[model samples]
Structure formats: structure tokens, C-alpha cells
Target chain A: MNDDVTIATAQQLIEFLGTFAFAISGIRHAAAKHFDWFGGYVCGIAVAIGGGTIRDVMLGATPFWMTNPIYIICTALALCMVILCSKRMERLQNAWFVFDTLGLALFTIAGIQKSLDYGQPFWVAIIMGCITGSAGGVIRDILLNNEPVILRKEIYAMASVAGGFVYWGLSELDVAIQLTALLSFVITCAIRFLAVRYHVSLPQLKTDDEINRVDNG
Target chain B: MNDDVTIATAQQLIEFLGTFAFAISGIRHAAAKHFDWFGGYVCGIAVAIGGGTIRDVMLGATPFWMTNPIYIICTALALCMVILCSKRMERLQNAWFVFDTLGLALFTIAGIQKSLDYGQPFWVAIIMGCITGSAGGVIRDILLNNEPVILRKEIYAMASVAGGFVYWGLSELDVAIQLTALLSFVITCAIRFLAVRYHVSLPQLKTDDEINRVDNG
Candidate 1:
């Protein structure tokens, strides 16, 4: 029981760090938009907490934030760090990207695990994982008055779904929990990083032909 | 069955109009934040669809907006209006408020009805109604870099909850569907209007003392 509790705590810590990194991304964007410190802080917190809140609400759980202040504190610390080290952080785009991808992988696995634990089917869990992985950034974009990066121009959610299938397959094979986590994480991060590298994405629905049709008609 | 089809068509129209109004609200906020027309359009569409998408996903249904293009067209129209009539809209606060509130009421009832149709309990239906009623605005606020008005000062969610209870009572008593709809609509709008008039709200959590402890210690 103690071992189980410790594992859970470690999982939560990884989640918090990911949430903080996610929040920092939003804060940086808000700062670029000339938002005040308060706005940056709020945006950061929203980006960190929004996805999980949506997932929890959908799953009929009290909001994850309501149960723990760690996420909140992580966001605050992220906010403070971003504000204090704005210039240095701005020069570390590659580092931030790596951190973001790692967070994305972790969040995807966490989402898939939670959905499976809830007794949802494999497909539902995969979709839920994608939603959990990408939603915070979606919320951030909407808040920042931009089109969601996920919806517009990224292979973001695709990576999450791909990772989710890997997770399901491994778990079904009765893989050890640590192995399952590592495999899912590697799959998600690799797919996301490669997609970013190759500029891979789903075709946008509004092709020039479609736009011309609407325009001409 | 003919009557049912007509009702369904009417419901579809209601959904479309609500989507338009809700999207316009998001567009207006985005415009105020100095987003370009495309950004405003996307934000509008997100705000319009976000709540319903959440409701649909939670119920394991296909997201209605993604299945239809009318919502996209409506959001585009809203964007055009905001861009072309920015000055005029700035003077139409009353009109915007009325439209926004009407959309809220309609969406609330629609959410309730849909959840009941899906065979959920009354409490769950009521919560769904509130989520549908308030979540778009919350998303808008998050995008606008503010704590949600509903969470901060609006008695917004309470009205939906009250209307939902009224819906439950009417359904239990075998009231005419139209009458029940009208009742929920009027009660929700009236309560919301009164609350806004009186600046009513739930007490906010006073986290200052807790934060002070964290800071000082």
C-alpha cells in the first residue's frame, strides 16, 4: 500500500511539473501580447489547469485542482519564474519545446490511464487522452485570442492518439506498469517531436477549392 | 412524427442562433483585445461550440457543430459584423446583453433536455444545463485573460440550476412541453436579470489567509 501511494505521489509530481511547463508557455505568450503580470499569471494558471478540469468535469470528478493546491503552486512558481527570467527564457525556445513535448507525453499517458481506470473502452480512452493532452493549449489559444494551434496547424493530437493506442496495447499484454508508462511516453514524445520536425499535419478542411466555391457562390 | 420533425428543425434553428450569438460574444471580446478578424472569428466559433462540444463528448455523442457547417458560417458572419460594425456595436451594449442572455437561457434548456433524453438523472441534467449555460462565457473570459465572470461575480450558474429544478418539477407533473420550456426560459432570464441588477453572487473563497500563511511561513 505504501509503495502504491508512493508511485501515485510520483505520478502527481510529474503531472505538476508538466502543468507548470504548460502554464509557462501560456504566460510567455501572454507577455508577448503585452498582458500585465496579473494577466500572465492568470493565463499561465488557466493553461496548466484547464485541460484536467475539463476532463474531470466530463468524468464527474470534482475538479483535480479542488483536491490539491500543488498544481496551483506550480503555476504560480512558473509564472514568477517566467516574469523574472523573461529574457533568458525567451532565448531557450528549444529547451522549452523539449519540456513541452515531455509534458505532452506525460499528460497523454495520464489521460489514457485515467480513462482506462474509469472502465471506458479503448477508443474512448484514446480520444480522451488526446483531449486531455491538447485541451490546455486549446484553452490557452482561445484565451489568447488566437486560433487553437491544435486545430489549425499541428500534429499535436495525432501524437496523443497514437501514444494512447500503444498504451492500450501494452496494458492489454499485461506489461509492467513502469514499462507501460515508459513505452507510452516514448511513443508520444517521438511522434510529437518528429511531427514537429517534419511539419506533418492533417489537411485543413478549408482547401482553396472549398474556399473558392464559397466565394464564387 | 411530423410534429417531432418540425420541433427538431426548430431546435436546430435555436441551436444555430444560439451559436451565432455566443460566437459574437467571443468575437467581441477578442476584438476588444485587438485580435485580427480571423482570430476573432475563430475565438467566436470556439466560444459558441466549446460548451456544446463538452456536453456532447461527456454524453458520448458526436459533437454537433463539427457535423454541420452552419455554425462555421454563423461564426464567420459574426466576425464580419464585429469587424464592419465595431463602432456601432460599441454603442449596442443593451442589444448585445439581451442576445447573450437569451442564448444562455436557450442553451441551458437545450442542455437539460438533451441530458434527460440521454436518460441521465435530474441532478446530472441540471449540472449539464449549468455547464452549457456558463462554459462558453467562461471560455471567453479565459481567452480574454480574466477569471470567469460566473465564478467571480455573476449569479449566472445559479439561474440555470434554478431553471433546471423547475424543468424537473414540470416534467414530473406532466406539464406541456412548450409550457415547461417557456417556464424554464422565463425563470432563468428573470433570475439572471435580477441577480445582475442586484449584483448578486456567491461568496468567493478567501484564500488570502491561507496564502499569507504559505508566504510568511
Candidate 2:
């Protein structure tokens, strides 16, 4: 009589999968920065939950991770995986990047869905999607003492933006929820992968000279 | 009998004052980084609200700035102040530094007060105090592409922690709320000023060698 149990378990599994991938990406960066074990685990958890936390705060909802222990467990597992495979992971340069991109795609879709469920407008949903996909890395980069590459380098947030538009458009066309989510994820990953692979990037703003001149006046 | 109106206005004024100072500091740093007007304004808002946002999220409360428009107005006004006096502010270094220190002190007191209001423990209140004092600068530095100086420099967070302990201790002694807040402010600023005056600083972590050795083994 009820599919709720089955759907809830499936959702939990995907959330855990995404959290683990994000945590691995964070732990790798923390290791690169030579953070102690506890520090590394903290970074892992931060990267795993940062985006969703931001979204939840904006939506006036309790953070998703605080309601469940799965994210924390997944983060610990990710830390262990990284510690055990540090030497080998160092050789597999693309591994964390792939996982990071996949995590971004999944989180973006989930973020947009959550925002929609909150009855937020489409623009807010898109922005929330971008935040979901990219804010984890932004926070991680901050923790690692580096400027977030998203703000300057990668074609990152744009992919999430593009995916948000497609997901919304699909829904407007009466697409089913599962199919719409799948399409959005595929679009996000495809855009991200293609852009990174082809060296596509946004133009860097150059305002030094202009700002200087204005100030001098 | 509804002096709620008068007290609310006074609280709003102080909140705006602190927000303005924080946004000014953030705008100054963004200006040094040569960010465009829009970029600089974004950075300023981020720094102004970042600390309290983190505190509110952890407390499961709505972000303080979101419920009112005053904080946003304060940030915009701060941006305008920086723009109008970019050259003059550069000359009045001591003035801006004083404002920043005052901002830190006030935010620390306010943060601890908020946490206590939420019925959080003393330790959590103390940590939240440090975060409210320092996390804005951390976020600002990250956005500007640098390691947060608070992690290794001066007595920034320590001062907040000390103030938190003092405030909690005084409260335990049944000190009045107003007096406790004022004393905490003075203590935080005194520690920060004394430390800066004497060149006190925490040592940088150097764990790369140990971590590398462990990995090699």
C-alpha cells in the first residue's frame, strides 16, 4: 500500500553515495595541504555537507546532515579510503576529479529539487543548484587556503546553471520526476566534462587599471 | 507599554553599525585585490554576514540578517563609504583598524549572547564567539585567494575565546546581562590590542614531513 519506504531508502543510498564522493574529493585536498588526521576528516565532512547546509539555511530548514548520521559515516569511510590509498591515489590523478564532478551533478539536481519543494522561484532554484554543485569546493578551497578555482578557473557553476534550466524546462514539458532528474544529471556532467576537457572557461575580469584610474580621480 | 519598539530600534542600530564595519573591512580587502564594483560589493556582503550566518545555521535559527533589510542597507552603505573615501581610508589606517577591532569585539559578544539564548553549552558558545569574530575575515580572505590569517596569526580567535569564558564566568556569578556584555567586549579588544602591540602570534603548523613519513611507511 505504500512505496514510501522503498523510495526513502533509495534516496538515502544516493545521498550517501554523493556524500562519500564529495568527502573523498575534500580529503584528497586536505591531504595535499598536509592537514592532521582530525583536520582532514573535518574538511571531508565540510565538503560533503557545505552546499546542502547553505541551501537549508536559506530555505529556513534544518540542515539535512544534522537529521541523519549517514553523511558522517560516509565521510569517515572516505577518509579511510584516502588514507589507505594515498600512495595509489596520488598516481590516479583523474579519480578524485571524476568523483568530484559526479558528486557535483548529483548535488545540483538534489538542490534544485529541494528548492522547488520549498516553493522557491525558478531563478532561486538555479542559483541554489549552482551553490549546491560548486559551494562545497569553494568552502574546501577556502579551508585549504586557496582562492576557489570556481570563481576564476573552471567552467564549474555554469554547468549547474545549464542543468537547472534543462531540468525546469523538462518539468514544464510534463516530464516525469525520475526522467527529469536523470536528464539534468547527464546534462550537468556532460557540460562539465566537455568544458574541462576542451579548456573552456569564463573570461577573467581585469579591473586593476580601471579601478586605479577611478580612485586616482 | 510596548517599549519593544524602542529597544528593537536600538538593537537594529547596533547591528547595522557592526555590519557596516565588517563590510568596510571586506570592501577594503576586495579593493586591494582590484575587484570590480559588483565583485567588491559581493565580497563586502559576504564578510559582513558570513559569521552570523554560520552561527545561525548551527543554532538552527533563521539567519539574523535575512529577517530584516537593515543589514543589507548597512552593507551597501559601507560599500559606498569605501568608494567615496578609498584614498582617504588608505590614509586613515588607524581609524579603520579601530573600527575593525570594535566590530570584532561587538560581534563576539553578540555571538555568545545569541548562542546562550539558544540554550547552547558554554563551550559551544565560546567556539561560536570565536567564529563570529573571525569567520568573516576567513571567508573574505578565501574569496580574495589567501590563507586565513586567523588560523596562524595574532590573538584573533583566542581573544574571542577568552572573552567568551569571561562572559560565561561572569554570568555564572549572576552578573547583569548588560554589564557582562560590556566586560566581554573590553576583554576581547584588550587581548587583541595587547597581542598586536606585543607581536604575539601562534606558530605555524609544519606537519608535512611527519605525514609524508607516515605515508611512505
Candidate 3:
């Protein structure tokens, strides 16, 4: 019971930090887009919470955020930080990206572990991990009036999938949970960083011909 | 075999019309938000297809749009209509709302029936109906830089839930499929209209301090 309680507490703290990171990333994007402060703050919160909300609904559970106020409080704090530090933040884009990637890695492992706890199959857990980690950012991009960066260009979702698979493989091998989580986070972040550094991208669907035909018509 | 084919054909037509209606609504919202034509069209198409995509993903089935080209074609047509008829379309707001609501009803039943076909229980099917009906609009609203109107004010999701229950109730009574569909559609629309007309709203959750303290802060 004590171990379980400690794990749960750690999970809560991780989720809060992950939410704060996501909110900060979203606020930075909104700042670049010149959105009003209200818009920026709301978008930041949405980016932080949207994926997990969708995941919960899909799992037929009440949204985790609705049950706990910590996510909201953390998002508010993120907003305050953004408002207070916008000038410094504008020069720290590289640092922000690193923070964002770390947040993604942490969230992906959280998702994988949660799905495993729910007794889902490995593939399902991995997919859920991807959803939990990346869907919020996809929603954030869409809300920011852009095609999802993941679909257009990036190793975003792929990173989550890789991390999920790593977690699954570790579990199958009966690895220690802490070791599995740590390794999964490292692998996910590495893949994301490598993809960015190398401009690695999934092939965009071959829609050029279709676009041409439609345009001509 | 022939009868099955005919049923499938009819279902396909309904699905196409529903998709077109949903996409058009999104495009219109994008336009109203002052997005460029391409952006509007893209937003509209995404809104139209997004709910069904989520449903499929959760059900572990191929996404509906990817399974067939009809959805794509319908979105294309919707986009063309919006572009070509932008001026005249301004006068069709009410007409568009009606069609959008019709599409919502159709999609809700589509989702519920599909879930039932997959042998999910009534509660799950009802929830799926709401997700199919409203999630697209929620997505579109968020992307257009707004809190989801449905969540904020409209009795939108409630209408979907009502229609879902209607479907379940009718099915329990061994009602004819067409009649049940019609009843579900009508009931949902009526509820939605009443909600809009009377400004019906759920009580917003507030902190106790907010309730007791005047916003003199």
C-alpha cells in the first residue's frame, strides 16, 4: 500500500510538471502568433490537457483533470510565468524545445504505464501511449491554425510509439518498473532529438496528383 | 446478398451526406473566423471527418475516411460549394444551422449503430453517439480559436445524449429503424432549438470563494 501510494504521488507530480511544460510550449506558440493574453493562456491550458482528456474518454473514465484541480492550478501558474517572462522566453526557443521534448517523453511513458495498468494489450497500450503523449500537441497545432506538425513534418508521434514499444518490451522481459520508465523516456527523447537534428520525417501522403487534379477541375 | 448490398449502398449515401454537411459547417466557421479560403476548406474537412476518425481509432478499426474515398470526395464538393457561394452563403446561416443539426443527428445514430454492431453496450453506444455528433464541432471551434460553444453555452452535447437515449428506447420497443432514426433526429433538433432559443445552460462550476467574494480583487 505504501509503495502504491508513493507511486501514485509521483505520478501526480509528473503529470503536473508535464502539464506545465505543455502549457508553456503552447503559450510560446501563441506569443509567436501574436494572440491576445487570454487566448494564449487558454490555448496553453488546452494543449496541456486535451490529449489526456481524450484518452480518458476513450477509456470510458471521467477526465483526470476534472477529478483533480492540480492540472488547472499548474496551467494557471504556467500562464503567469509566460506573462512575466515573455521577453526572456522569446530568446529561449531552443531551451523551450528541449523542455517540450522532455515533457513529451515523460507523458508518453506515463501513458504506456497507465494503459498497461488498465490491462490493455501491448499494441493497444503503445497506441494509447502515442495518443496520450502527442494528441494534445496535434490539437494545439490545429487550434493554432496549422496542420499538425507530427503529420506534416517531425518524429513526434513516432517517438511516442518507440517509447511505448520499449516499455512494452521491457515489461515482457519483467524488467524493473523504474528502469523501464527511465529507459522509455530516454529512448523517446533521443528519437525526437535525432529526428529534429536530421530533419527526419514520415513521408507525407502522396497527394500531389490528387491536388493537381482537383485544382484543374 | 442483393439486399445486403442495397442496405450498404443506402448507408453509404447517408454517410456521404453526413460527411458533406459536417465539413461544410467547419468551412463556414473557418470563413467566419477570417481564415483564408484554403484554411477554411481544410478546417471544414477536418471537422467533418474528425469525430468519425476518433470513433474508429477507439474501436480499433480503420478510420472511416481512409476506408473509402467517398468522404474525401464529399469534403471536396463541400469546399467547392463554400468557395463558389461565399456571398450568397451569408444569407443561408439558418439553413446551414439546420443542415448542421441534421448532420449531427445522422452522425450520432451512425456512431451508436456502429458501436452496437460491434456489440458494445447501450451506455457506451450512447456516449459514442455524443462523441460522433459533437466532437467535430468542438474540434472546429477550438481550432478557430474559441472555447467549444457546445461546452460553454449550448445544450449541444445534451441534445446528443437525449437522441442517443431516444434511439435506445426506440430500439427497445422494436421500432422500425427508419422511424427510430427519424424520432432521434427530430428529438435532438427540437431539444437543441429549445436550448438555443431559451439560452439554457448548465451551472458553471465555481470555487466557493468566488461565489462568496465579490470580484473586487
Candidate 4:
């Protein structure tokens, strides 16, 4: 019983960290866009909970943030951090990137586990994982009026997808849940780190003219 | 019972027309952006169902489109119409505008009613109504890499909110549901029409610099 309680506490801690990291990323972007404080706070909350909300809605479950006020508090704290140390935070770009990657990894695993618990098929769970890991940034970009970087050239969603596949494989091989989650998280972070370091990106989709030319030919 | 069936049928018809119009708007925007056929279809689906999906999730209900394939078929038909008659459809811009306005009116009423049915307060319902009427367009703009026009200069969402107020007032006075819906729809459409005709718009939100100056002073 104590072991279960400890595990649950650890999971909650990871969730809080991930939410804070995502919220900070959103507030920084909002600051860059010259949004007011309220706008910054809204963007921060959206980024921190956006992915989980989408995942939960798709899985027909209550959104995790709605059940607890902790996520909101985390976002508020993130906003305060950004407001108080904007210059210092900007200088800690590398630190933020690491935190963001960690958040992505943790959210992906949580999304997969939740979907599976809700009896979704593995494929659907995998998609949910990717959505949980990446959709928040998409929402933030949309709000900031920027094209979603993940939809364009980032290796972001792909890394989440890869991590999901790894999770599925490990679960199939009867791996312990904690070990599987840890391995999946590490793999997701590794892929994101390597992709960014190596400047790897997916090919862009074909434009209308290209599709039309092919059709005519 | 016969009258009730007729009313239900009429409501379903309005929903189909709204879905079709919203899908067409999204597809046309995608085409203008040079997105390929698949991209256009995705945008169409997103715009057609996005708002309702958000509303349903917030209200803790299953998304409406999940239970009915008709919305998908409507979007498909819309895509076909766009593909076959792009030039002719452009010539019918005024007709499309009318259809789009009609859609906005219908969706706002529907959203308000759904929220009320789910036991939400009047204010929450009004917000849901505005979201239903305007959010799909915002999603489409984001997908097309444009700033959401509704956020910039359109009096679109305000019209929906106004209609929701009318609905709430009439409902509180014990008006028939059908009459309430009709009045709300008409009010929404009229506001949209008059606003567009007279160039009405809400003021833009204050930027970071403006807020900072105010704080300092």
C-alpha cells in the first residue's frame, strides 16, 4: 500500500513539473508576441493543459485539469516566474529546452496509460500519446498567430509517436509498467534531443500545384 | 408527437446546412493556402465539427459527430462542390456568405440549448454559444497560417453572445423552446448582418508595452 502511494506521489510530481515547464514555454512566447498579462496567463494555461484536455476528450474521460486546481496553480506559478525573471529565463534557454523535452516525455506516457486504462486500442492510445505530448504547442502557436511548428518541420510529434511505439512494444513483452514508462520517457527525450542537435526534420507535404501537376500528368 | 417529430426534423436539417457551409468555408480557405486535397478535407472536417466537439467535451457529453456519420458526408459533399465549381462558387460569394451567417446563427442557438440542457448556468451557455459560432473559423484560420479574423475585426462572436442573452431572457419568461431558438437565431443573424454592413468591431486587446506603461505610471 505504501509502495502504491509512493508511486502515485511520484506520478503527480512528474505531472506538476511537466505542466510548469509547458506553461513557462507558453508565457515566454506570449511575452515575445507582446500580449498583456491576462493574455500571457491564458496562453500559459492553454499550453499546460491543452494536450491533456484533447486526449481526455478523445478518450471520453473528464479532463484531468478540471478535477483539480493544481494545474492552474502550476501555470500561475510559471507566469510569476516569467514575470519576475524574464531576462534570467531568457538566458536559461538550454534549461527550458531540457524541461520542455522532459514535459513532452512525461505527458506522452501519461496519455498512453490513461487511454489504455479507458480501454482504447493500442493504436488509438499511441495517437493520444502523441497528441498529449505535442498538441499544447499547436494550440499555443495558433493563439499566437504562428503556424504550428510541429505541423511544419519539427521532429516533435514524430518523437512522441516513436516513444508511443516503444511503450506499446514493451508492454506487449510484459514489461513492468514503471520500467516501461521510464524507458519510453528516455527514448522520447533522446529522439527530441538528437533531432534538434542534428537538425533532422520531416519532409513538407505537397502543395496544391504539385498535386495538380501530378494529376494532369 | 407529430409536431415534435417535425421540429426535430427541422433542427436536423439546419444542422446539415450549417455543417455543409462551414465545411465549404474551410475547404476554400485551404485551397487559397495551396494545401493539397487531403489537407483541404482535414480542414473542412475540423471547421465543421470543431466547435461542437469543444462544446460537448466541456459539457461532459459525447461529441455530436461521433454518433452521426452525416456530418462527415456533409463535409465530403462540400469538398466535392468546391472541387467541381471553384470558379462558380467564387462567383456565388454572396450566397456563401448568407449560408455562413445562417450557420453561425443556428450553431449559437444549438450550443446555448445544449449547455442549458446539461445544467450549465446562463453565462456559461452564452460563452459556449459564442465559441460554437466563432471557434471553427478560428481553427480554420490557424490551420491556414493566418491570424484568426474573428479575433481581429469581426463582430462575429459578439453577435452570438447577444443572441444567447436573448435566448436566456425568453427562456426565463417561460417561452416555448422552439420560439426561443427561432428568436435567438434571428437575433444572431441580424446582428451579424448589421455589423458587417456598418463595419462594427470590438477594440483590440492592449499589448504588453501598453500594459507595462500603465503599470509604471
Q: Name the candidate that leads on lDDT.
A: 4
Better of 1 and 4 by DockQ: 4
Which residue runs of candidate 4 sit more than 4 Å off their true CA positions? Answer: A35-46, A76-85, A143-145, A197-217, B1-53, B57-113, B119-130, B143-145, B149-217
lDDT of 1 at B83: 60
Question: lDDT per residue, candidate 3, A126-156, as tens digits?
Answer: 7667778888886778768865556445678
The residue-by-residue lDDT of candidate 1 on B18-107, one tens digit each, is 777788888867655555454465468668877887888888766665355677788888877766655656577776677777778888
lDDT of 4 at A86: 68
For candidate 3, give the DockQ. 0.06
lDDT of each: 0.78, 0.80, 0.77, 0.85
DockQ of each: 0.06, 0.15, 0.06, 0.11
* Best of the candidates, DockQ: 2
Per-candidate TM-score, chain A: 0.88, 0.87, 0.86, 0.91
Model 1, residue B85: what's the lDDT? 58
Better of 2 and 3 by lDDT: 2
Relative to the real complex, the DockQ score for model 2 comes to 0.15
Docking class of 3: incorrect
Q: Local error of candidate 4 at B210, Å? A: 12
Estimate, for each residue in A7-75, the C-alpha lDDT of model 4 and write its tens digit. 789877777878888998888777776665645665787789899988887777767775667887898
